[model samples]
Target: MTPLPVRIAGTGVHLPPDVVTNRRLAETLDTSDEWIVNRTGIRERRWLAPDLATSDMCVAAAHPALAAAGCAVRDVDAIVVATYTYDQPLPSTALIVKEALGAFRALTFDITQAACANGVQALFLGSLLVRTGAARRVLVIAADSASRVTDPEDRTTRVFFGDAAGAAVLTGATTPGTGLLGWDFGAELSYDVEIPAGGSRQPAGATTFADRRHYLKMNGRTVWDTATRCLPDSVLNATAKAGLTVDDVAHFFLHQANLNIVRAAMDKLGVPRDRAPITVDRLGNTGSAGVFTVLHKGFSEGTVRPGDAFVVSAIGAGFQWGTLCFRA
Candidate 1:
């Protein structure tokens, strides 16, 4: 008997055409390009038009991945869309993506309120389903339209976010450690410190709108500090579970949160700066799409190679954090 394998068939990414530079942002906010770049490593980011939505970018990314994998839309057995921003509350963004991609036969579902780490969480779940015979080819898409929740006057988040999507196709295989090797997940619910008002606790209405609770808010210093201390341990834990050392991995894909966080985590893990792949400088923080976008950029630029072991780790709201080890 052969053990089922979860192999990544293909990867794709999509960024909107609108590029919002820090210099451009400085025109309205009380901030400068140097300040934003020095802190976040973000020079610019993509933004969608007012008419465009999260599912639009997701479908765009998924189509290329499906084409690259030589699989038609019908070949997808499941579709998992990781997003905090949705086109609507009901029917799910997953169904919208499936319909747009023409995946008439796919089992589609949405994973919501997952910030930067949502992509990996979706991948982990999709991989398990494939390895367990629950599905065959699963399309995992991470997308965000954070501009909707952003307050243009608030320079902190306005300078850090952009709209984008990324996708990967996971399929059953016969090889061990071919795709996801191991995963580690942790959440500090004590710091559900960031939220916009669309919930039972604060339903959408005129009062909430007046309070501006529907816009993004954060304790940046707190989240950054927590991420620095937690991410390296998450990486180490995942590597240990997969029976590999940190030195054994070829490429490290950290979430594109900030330059300082990456440096701090690497210092803690004792991993060299040269091993990490980063794209926050040009793409900004793409919410859940950040990790996969960086990984895709690495692959395109020849930073990643075949048969090489790699690790991807992310920390964000739930206050969630997670890691996934893989063989490329």
Candidate 2:
């Protein structure tokens, strides 16, 4: 079936007020600011307050997006939230966002598999829903409090994660061929990045808590290698599907996973450095919120101009990854 056209009308991001500098981490851990910067290219990151949760940040981001889209809460037809951090396990964070935004009419759910790629995955799903006539307008949000799950004692993980939220409003394109062009998503069947426990398989227990199995875990080398190889391929595949090429993309909104990883992918795809805007240096890897956060920053800074064609790509836990192409 021919899919309907979809476009991103507006984008918004909310970062917690608390800033954690590499120096601050170094003060407690055995790592230094220089070491972290040289390794991850992250200088500082925002950590959410103990009192706040993922839904709070999602609501904070959603308001600006709806306003920017000239859309009201009542007008939204569906809400898709991408996050692994829910305040509780029962009611989905998407529903919480819908209630918080007072968008009682919207169908709400959550998507959690893509991990850091959740934002792009949500965008793809929202676009499909809008295109299929299942929804006229969709509010797609990705929020995460990675700090809450990060083990401070684990310097490797603690130094790289932070808290943030990002959102976008998607709807049918006013002009055809001016929105989403093509996308590709896939999982490579690996657990290179994951939280080992807390799910039904291991359910929370004393053993899990003592082992810190609930905290986020990663095989950094595996992720780096996998992303370096897969991200560029995904982008190329999606663009080719749309009858475009790497040179045709005006901007690149790749995941803010690591500075080196992004640089490697861009070099491999032959995308010049000037064409990609990165936010990981200051924001750290915000997990699912990273892609949209970078996109929102570009739009606000006027670096992403109207009629620009951009590619969004990410690799996350569950060995999941994807690429999305759009015309702004």
Q: Write the per-residue lDDT of candidate 1 for residues 1-328, one digit (tens) a residue.
A: 1223677777889989998888999999999989998888888988888998999999999988887677889889999999988888887999988888889999987877658888889888888889788888999999988888788888877888888999988887565556677778998784434666888989999999988888888778887888998899999998888888899988888988887788889989998987887788888888889888977776656666767888888987868889988886
Best TM-score among the predictions, by candidate number? 2
For model 2, residues 140-189, the per-residue Cα lDDT tens digits are: 99988999888989997999998999999998887756778878887888
Local distance difference test values of all predictions, in order: 0.84, 0.89
At residue 206, give the lDDT of candidate 1.
96
Which 10 residues in a row give candidate 2 its minimum summed lDDT? 1-10
Model 2 ranges off by over 4 Å: 1-4
For candidate 2, give the lDDT of residue 118.
Answer: 85
Model 1 scores a C-alpha lDDT of 0.84
Q: Measured by C-alpha RMSD in angstroms, how accurate is candidate 2?
A: 1.2
For all candidates, the clash counts are 0, 0
